[model samples]
Target: MIGKQLKPNFIFEASWEVCNKVGGIYTVLSSRAQTLLKEYGNKLIFLGPDVWQGKNNPDFIEDKKLLKNWREAAAKEGVNVRIGRWQVEGKPIAVLVDFQPFFEQRNSIYRTVWQNFGVQSDKAYGDYDEASMFSYAAARFVEIIYLSLIHKNKKVVYQAHEWMAGLGMLHLCKAAPSIATIFTTHATSIGRSITSNNKQLYKYFHGYNGDQMAEELHMDAKHSVEKQSAHFADCFTTVSTFTDKECAQLLEKSADVILPNGFDNAIVPKGSAFTAKRKAARKNLLRVASALLSEELFDSTMIVSTSGRNDFRCKGFDVFLQAMANLNSELQRQSTENCKTSVLALIEVPCWMKEPRKDLQQRLAEKEIPNTALPNPYLTHELYNEGEDAILNTMRSLSLMNDRNNPVKVILLPCYLDGEDGIINKPYYEVLLANDLCIYPSYYEPWGYTPLEACAFKIPCITTDLSGFGQWVDATLKHRGMIENGVEVLHRNDDNYFDVAQNICNTTIKVLNANKTIRNKMRKNAAALADKAQWNNFIKYYYQAYNFALSKKLK
Candidate 1:
């Protein structure tokens, strides 16, 4: 039986994506903020970089009165900060620190870091300087707050997320040893580099040295800080068991607790609102597809999508296209028999886009859906480098002509769907509710938020066992690959690209062929699985990590 856990009196969480929405870490932090707020209330403070100083950040609501005293104190200490409440469910307090001043002293700071923690910054490149300076600023902010506000007797837990905030964790470990520090690595720097470089990460995991790989991948500085933070933190944690294993092998430290990323289901619409929103989503999606293709689509049409960061190989875009081509071939063959099965597959991954295609926009503006197709109807946006664009190149290679006669149509919406992408103009979640299925066959996903979000919307999805969320699904359900379970975890590995593609095609056919009763049951099951992953249930693991970290203070 598990023992009673010690709760933290105050929790200071730091991440690069506190108010800045970038990737999956933003979803993890933002979605779970409400649950943390309910438990810790005003004591739960979030620290993020002040990247949105002059600009308007829609996700943050600035309030000068929130932490007026601390802000005044911080200003006197040469620390610039903006105190606000993150515009989410709980509206928790957020402190955005400006780290620009620290860049002037970066050289000396790096030398001191090297002297104390042996973190090598000599070969650092790219965003290393910016991230490190921001991390140092966050650490300074935390130290100042701890010294001014909180009593020494109070239990404090300082949790840092990802390699971007690793340096802050290290700083807190030394500056305020009494505060329990917890380092959570969503994905290791070296591990991602290894996979992105097309190296077979899983096969040669035991043989590859983290330091050697980091040097080879030119990620020495980031890896050094991340590994050291993992080793030195009072409690080291990861988002999933799969990542826990990766941390052990790559970062050379096993996690004390697995803090699986969870969602707040309250954001999802329910009852009549859900039905109406889903209808609107489907209507808008079909209308846009019809306008782009100049083909009238029936109400029986199916919308399937794959969305995430534009990591072509890692996110399995190659396999997604291959499977779509295969499905297209099968559908084209079946089209001769007057089959009305229409599958509109949307690639909602953001890319380096210049602007929305003017021709597509004009077509959308037309009062009636034309029967004539626009040139290059496969793409919704005009890319900066069309020839080098991976999605377009792959579509060309596969000869995936967005033909009006073909049953399977593909459209690339190469921009973020923050309700103003000029085409579908709907928030991602609103668009997600319209889909019948979502696919994310990632080869190196840490914890896939795309599939989790899909499940939350009661949409059955296909993901690979390689993803952290897919592994969780496998553990939750005795078996996978059945559509009834709401998720089909396709087996993916270094050598099984074609096999995975075939599996995806087969699963798509099965889902499309499934009756309404079966599909409804699958949708219900998907939401049920996602309900099990709500923050209310998963936040206990965080409490567990805090207990472990605070227990270290007693030692």
Candidate 2:
């Protein structure tokens, strides 16, 4: 059984995404900050790589005065650091390390690790060195802080996120034995690599050997580090059982505890405020799409979206576009279209953004939006790789342009929606409320934060069984994929691509066609699911992990 609360603690959580708005891990750490801070208060701290160097990172609020003594000591010991608070809700203390200087001694550092742990670095490539150096540097700083300052009576726990921070986790395990270390592999490196390489991961999952697959896929260096760290850390944890199984099979270690990622609804507006922001968000959505397409969208239209990183096959962007294309055809064949237009699909995945179209900008600024479609009317921002962008290519192949006669219109807002992205100048969650439906048919996902976040925002979301969130919905909520129930968790496996697409197409058709009464019920159901997924409900699992780590250290 998972254990209990770790009171009076000195906790240090490390992640490559601590203050960096990269992916799901950032959401995991940032959303959990407030709860952790409430328990540990000023004793809670986070260590992240200083990837931005001296440049301003909007997510970070630096204060040289925050830890002056520690900063001076770090400087004296050759550990370059910047002490600050993460710019999220709790404003929890964060320390960003500049690991750039460690390149000079990389060979020595690598040699030391190879000697201490059997992490072979001979075949390392790409971001291997960079991630290793960053984690290694974080480990050194953690060791210094623990050995030199922290009292023996102080209960200390250090948690490292993903394979990128695995080296740091292992380092602390070896260097500071008293400091309980936890390693969380959000997704196994080999598993993701196998899925991405188009291998039938689930079909032959049991038949495969992790080491053999790693050698075949050229993921030896990363897999070695991740595997070792998982074994060495006092408490090895994963976000969900889906990945827990993956670790056991691929990394050869079962997680001691499953710390599922949770959401914090503090940023979500209540009652009257929610109604107002949602109205504003809808207005923004319609205006942006209408202005870009130069055609007015009726208020009765439904806005559909799929978002997250631009990993085409892995994130299932290919399937989404194909499904939307099928949706356009299906809606066109309908006896009579009830809604103003069938669907307004937004591909909010960030990629190769050059700038927002000046013509589109001028149109939005005008008293009335221009009636003529701008050049490349389907795209919100100009892309540097327009000729080769996967989304654009897929859309063109499926003939999904925002043609004036098409019932379903598609637009690609391929830029980060951080309020300053020339079009739709609003943060992601602020605009997320406008969506009538959200879909994430991930081919390779560990926890699937997008679908969870979508459900939390009261939007009916359709996800696949392969995603961790999707599995949780099936087991917890009884796999009820009815429109009246809000979420549709489709059965997706390595072999069922077309089936998943057809399901998404049918699901959207049914959900978007529902009447007002049914839609409200769906919203209510989605919100209920979100309530169950809040950090308050999920934070106990983390304490359980910490408690286990502390117990392991005692052993």
Candidate 3:
């Protein structure tokens, strides 16, 4: 059932988060999974890092016979096979390396490294052992996959995600040089570091001490892994058209093709008849605002919010904060007769949990820095309900301080939310329904999904001209006044925080004043634009990636 494809095509993917994820890669892979199963079921072999099951619930017993056959084949092909599996949903999917060696010794490694460097583990370093073990285990897993597919007489296309799995693909090439490899980086380490290092103010407020943290975590190896990944892959792919160009320059390796990540349209809110979607969005915002009001965080009137994984520096949370502060100043300039609006922008970011170690160590060592990062408080429960109480409690704090009578309220929600909650996770739909506008000024986004999502919801969103989606939407619509003048797109680096704030304020003013019919037209235009990115069309591109690799074509 697993290997009988109508066409002889296969995708060998290595990732830290395919089976379990920490970022957007999970959404991309999950969206494509059913389709891959439908089109390339027999040929698709997903190879992931082999995290140990240990005494965890529902033990996953690897198919020893199948594994033995794989190992025997690898031995014949002169490739080392490291085969194992972590228990996921009670079945084994052939995860490659046993990570227990690294996991078990993590505390010791942390103690040794941090203590040697005269730093504490919690304060200076973060999951150092987990990252290191992930790389080692991932590399070994790819070696096993190289033997399984290549030695077994299968033509395959190997796609590695980020630096973690990028190394794995490189390791695989040592054993199977003919395997076509695709490397995709969701974000670059250097680009992010620039923001973190340049802005000391960010670490100061966010409860993270940047200078000390940087010294312990080795930012240098992060750059090295990125460069190595770019150099080794036959072809490179990034999540967005904008990111494709950004990555080539940042990593100094040209991408063969730019594959903008696609989303599952079915999961998106659609159609006017989708009242439940509308309700879900509205309720979520109200719940969040209510919580903040209860907590006494602010007394502002205009409530502005942004959500994402809690990497504040790169996601432009600081920009949003500064913009809101600017908006506040501008609002104050208005006379009582000119219409005053008070605003509070809430920035939400979910912390990254799992990290790849090889790059981590390499980075720390190269910089001669020693540091560790902390896991998020809500890491254990990804869904909104699991962390609902905490979220409400956080909101309650904000609400108690902020006046409900104020013109605007701004808040930052740094949590992982889902659809089941009917509110917090409904980003675009909710933001469109409640507020006048949403801000997504990403410093480096690989094919941003939010802008398109907001457009689909009929929300007038402000994205940077540097974004792939912004460029695409602006180009397609030709700015024919379909969207509000305030619904304008600005280039990120072209302006400082002041200029950025002015543009945002001006756009908000424009959209808030736009005629009803015109606003409706913009919504239609957004939905039309989103239709172009349907999964059906995007799947073909993926198929082509596999086909090109199979045919041994460079492009």
Tell me how far the alpha carbon of residue 365 in candidate 3 is from the true structure, in angstroms, after superposition.
52
Clashing pairs in 1: none
Measured on C-alpha atoms, candidate 1 has an lDDT of 0.89
What ordering of candidates by lDDT runs from best to worst?
A: 1, 2, 3
For candidate 1, write residues 38-145 as lDDT tens digits: 888999999999999889898888899988998888888889899999988889999999999999989998898888899998989999999999999988888887
Which has the higher TM-score value, candidate number 2 or candidate number 3?
A: 2
Give the runs in model 2 whose Cα sits over 4 Å from its true position.
1-8, 335-340
Q: TM-score for every candidate vs. truth? A: 0.98, 0.97, 0.68
**TM-score (C-alpha, index-matched) for candidate 1:** 0.98
* CA-lDDT, candidates in order: 0.89, 0.87, 0.53
Per-residue lDDT, model 1, residue 361, is: 85
| Backbone clash count, each prediction separately | 0, 0, 74
Return the lDDT, model 3, position 533. Answer: 68
lDDT of model 3 at residue 152? 56
Candidate 2 C-alpha lDDT tens digits along 322-404: 89988988887783744245688999999999998888888888878766888887899888999999899999999988787
